[model samples]
Target: MPTFTALTTLVGKDSAEKLGEAMERLTPEPTGVGVFEIEDGSGLWEVGGYFTESPDAAGLAVLAAAFDAKPFVVSELPETDWVAKVKRELAPVKAGRFFVYGSHDADKVPVGSEPLLIEAAMAFGTGHHGTTLGCLKALDRIAGEGFHGRSVADIGCGTAVLAMGAARIWPETVLASDIDEVAVEVAEANVSANGLTGQVRCVEAAGFGHPDLAAKAPFDLVFANILKAPLVDLAPEMGANIQAGGFAILSGILNEQADEVVAAYDAAGFDVHTREEIGEWTTLTLCHR
Candidate 1:
C-alpha cells in the first residue's frame, strides 16, 4: 500500500492544532494528524497528515489559507521496509566504554566494553546519533573519573539506552521516563532485550512528574538527551532534583545553542564539567554545585 503525506508550517501552536483538527475532516480523511513545534528557536509549528489515499489538495489549500499556514507540500512515500533499511544503514556505534549494537552484530562485541543492545526497529537512541553518542561518551568519562552513580534517572529516555548504559556499570537501579507512552514501552522492551529488566525501570511522565521519579529525587546522576528549549526549562527542576556535587549529562543541543544551555544550567548552580561536539550536536557534562 502507498502512503501520502501533507505538511505545512504556521507561526502559532493554536493555528497549527486547528489546522490539524480540520485535516481530520477532509474527504479522503487523513489516517493520522500531527502538530509539533519546530525546535530550532523558530516560533513555528508544523502540521502534518498521513493518508493511505491521495489527499484533497483543494481542501488542504483552504485549510492552509484559513490558518495562515504555508501551502501544504504533498508527497507520496515509497513503500520501503524501514526496519530493514535501518538495520543495513545503522552499524554498531562505539562510545568510550560502551559498545551499542543490534542483534545482527551481536558477535562483534569487544572485550572489556559495556555492551548495550538496541534493535534498529526501536529507532531512537540506538547510540548512532551524535546526541546519544556524546552522552554515552560523557558517561564513560564521568565513570573514568571514579564517579559512581548511586541514584540515576534518564529523563526523556528514548530506548532507555542511556539508562541501560548507567545500569551496566552501576549497581543502582536507573529510572527512565518519557512523556510519550509509546516511548516508555519501547524503553521497557529495550531494557528486557539488554537483560536489564530489574536494573532499569520505565515510566511515562514529563520531566519528574511521575511518582517513582519524584520519590527518587536528588539523583546522583541524570541523563536528559532532549532539545534546547526543554533543557533550558528543565534547569531549575534539575537543580532541585539532583544532589549537590552530582552530575548531569545533557545533549540534543545544536552546537550553536550550547552556550544558551550552559548559561541556563549555570544559573541553576551547575558548572560545565566538559563540553563535547560531535558533528553538529553538542553534549554537556555538568556538575551541580
Candidate 2:
C-alpha cells in the first residue's frame, strides 16, 4: 500500500481552509486534511491532504481553481515503518546539558547529561526538528547565563519537550499547554515517562487563556515553539504573563521570518537577547523589559 499527499499554498487563511475542507470531499477521499500558515512572513497558508489511495487530479484541480491556489503537487509515499525510520535517522540531539532522545536510544544517553526522553510519536516537538532543538539550545544558553527559573511555562507544548527540559534543569513547576487536547495528553504521557509527573503539569488551552496558566502568571521563562502568526498573536498575552526581566524562547519561525516575530515582541515590551538559526528555522531568546 502506498500513501499520497496533495499539497498547495494559497494567499489567505479562509481560502486555504476552504480548500482543505474541499479536499475532504474528493472521490477517493483523503484520510486527513490539514491547513497551516507558512512561517516565512509570506502571509500564505498551506493546505494539504493525505490519501491512502491516489487522489483525483481533476477534482484537486477544481478545488485549486475555486480557491485560486496553486496546483496541488501530489506525490506517492513509499511504505515503511516511519517510527523505525525516524529512530534510525534521528540521532540524539544535545543542547548544552540537555540530551533528547527516544527510548530506542536509551543506552546512548551520555554520562552527566540532563536527559529528556521524547519518543517518536504522533505529536510534534520531538527535538529532531530545528524548531524544537533550537528552543532547547536557547533554554540551555539562558541557563548557562546564570538564569534560574522560579516559574516557567511552555505554550503549545507538543510532547512537552521544552517543559521537561525546564523541569530537568530548574526547581520549578512548569505548566505545559497545547490547544489540541491530544497533544496535551501526549505531553502528560511524556512527562510521566520522563518521571516528571509532578514537575511538568499538562493542560489543554489556547495561548494563555486557561486558569492554570493564568494563575501561574509572571513567569520567569516561557517557551513557545509554534508558528509565526501565533507567535505574533501571542506577544501581548505573553508580555502580560511574563514578569519584568523574564525570558522567552520562541521558534517554529523560518530564517526570513525572524525579523517579523522580533518586531512584534519588541512592540510588546521585549528586547532581543539572542538569536540562533538552525537549518531554515530561527530561534529567538527575548527578555521582557
lDDT tens per residue, model 1, 1-289: 9999999999988878888899999999999999988978899999999999999999999999999999999999999999999999999999999999999999999999999999989767988899999999999999999999999999999899999999999989999999999999999999999899999999999999999998999899999999999999999999999999999999999999999999999999999999999999999999999
Tens-digit lDDT track of model 2 for 1-289: 8999999999988888888888888989899999997756578999999999889999999888988999999999889998888888888888889998899989999999999888876325777789988999999899998999989999999889999999998878999999998888889999999999889999899999899988888898999999888999999998898999999999989998899999999999999999999999999999999
Question: Which candidate number would show the highest lDDT if scored against the true structure?
Answer: 1
**What C-alpha lDDT do the candidate models reach, one value each?**
0.95, 0.91
| Per-prediction TM-score to the true structure, in the order listed | 0.98, 0.94
What lDDT does candidate 1 reach at residue 249? 97
Best by TM-score: 1
Give the clash total for candidate 1.
0
Superposition TM-score, candidate 1 onto the true structure: 0.98
